[model samples]
Target: MSKLLEINNLCVDYVSPNGIARAVNNVSISIAEGETLGIAGESGCGKSTLAFAISRLHKAPALISEGEILYKGQDVLKMNDKALREFRWNEVSVVFQSAMNSLNPVITIGEQLTDVMLAHKKVTPKQAYEKAAELLQTVGIHPDRLSAFPHQLSGGMRQRVVIAVALALEPKLIIMDEPTTALDVVVEREILNELYDLKAKFGFSILFISHDLSLMGEIADRIGVMYAGNMIELGEAKTVFSEPQHPYTQGLISSFPTIHGPKERLYGIPGNPVNLLQIPQGCNFQARCSHCFEPCTEHEPVLKTIAPEHHVSCHLV
Candidate 1:
């Protein structure tokens, strides 16, 4: 596959009373065309911050302090306002964690979808409606419900509608921030299954951010684990699942339960996520990592390839 998005030592900072908060610190990752890459970590781990930075969605308080976000060889940080407006919806879209709330309660679902298409695609009402209906159908919702209000739909239905609106522009890339966080397990499974089918049909790439490593391993072609604004590991999903090299990755894997397997004590990595405003000197995960040695506490390790396509950022690895 070809590289669709390449991020090089990307850093994001927020201006606060205490000074700068390093939300994303020297992070580098890539997603290929037609690939599904998963970003796994707990809340406040900078996973969503990475996604927002990729799309240039961060506000004034937050700034891209360093590095480049390259989309198809073009620097995303340099796109002009008009180009960014065109780039956002048509080329890259986002299905946010609370995206269901993005649906306007007062407007009919069809109108909301139509507005997006009209703004981005220069389409007429009829054409936009046709496309909207097709999008709704793709997510297994009835086309007629496009005329209904948001409250008229169930939580799952509303979320699916939000997804329909996201696919309205037929974007080449999408950033999904815990898209199934609000759904039940059954509904989450269904949505993920639908997402997989959609990826096959549309041939689009996804940068999926979530705390659920197990669910991500089930669908993502590649997985990257993040901790305290740093990427600790990156590799094929199966490889990371079977033999996670980084101690942080191993601890994360052990935290989840597996069906049809003998139960073991799940040791949630000790200590809270490192505060960006006051990060530790060395490795961010050093406080929680069990295999931390002297070098781990004194020096930060760069990501090194352990196995084929498996990168781990740890002294032991």
Candidate 2:
């Protein structure tokens, strides 16, 4: 497979009155063309930070401290303002968390979709309207609803609209930052099913971020597990689900329940996520890991390939 996006030792920091928080620490990963890569971790594990950094959308106190973000061999971290404006949406688009609520309540859905196409100069006003209606239909929404306000649409419909807008310019890559966080399981499943269908139809790659392991396993071609801003495991979804090498990955796998397997008690990983402001030395997950050893407390581990296309960061591994 060809590489679409490559992140190398990416680091992001948040500055505050108290101190600087290392939100993303030397994280490296990639998504192949026409592939789906899922990032899974707890709330404060920097998954969202990484997503924002990839799109060059980190703002305010958040700053990119180090590393390279390359999209299709072009350096993303060094793009000029004009270039970035052209790069975004045309090359890559983002479906933010709770994107359903991001719609302008006062604007008509058609206007919002048309605005994106117009902003990118991808189509004329008349063509934009035609494309907008077509996009709504593509997401399973009635074309007539383009004239409706956001408040008039249901949550699921609004989410589909957000996705429609992201697809208006036909970006090659879509970064979905927990796109279904606000929807119910049934609705989430429906959205994902449609998303998969759309991906097949458009051939765009996806970078899906979420805290749900089971969901990631269901949709992602590969899965990367993050903890305290560090990527602890990277492998095929099935391999990681069945034979996690990192202790943290194993603990995370144990926390989620399986659908067809025998019912078992949920076993949560002990200890909270490490504080980014004062991260411990050596392994970031050492405090919570059951297989921690002397080396785990003294030396940080680098990712090493354990099996074919499977990598792990841990002394024990």
Per-residue alpha-carbon lDDT of candidate 2 for residues 1-317, written as tens digits (9 for 90 to 100) = 99999999998999999999998888999999999999999989999899999999999799999999999889999999988987896999999998899999899999999998998875779999999999999999999998999999989999999999999999999999999989898988998999999999999999999999989999999999999888989999999998998888888888999888899999999889888888788888888888888998899999999988999999997
As for candidate 2, its clashing pairs are none
Best candidate according to lDDT = 2
lDDT of each: 0.89, 0.92
- What's the true lDDT of residue 6 in model 2? 94
Quote the lDDT for 161 in model 1. 90
- Candidate 2's clash total is 0
- Candidate 2 TM-score, C-alpha based: 0.98
TM-score of each: 0.97, 0.98
Q: How much lDDT does candidate 2 score?
A: 0.92
Residue 180, candidate 1: alpha-carbon lDDT:
92
Give, for candidate 2, the lowest lDDT window spanning 10 residues: 115-124
List candidate 2 segments past 4 Å from native: none
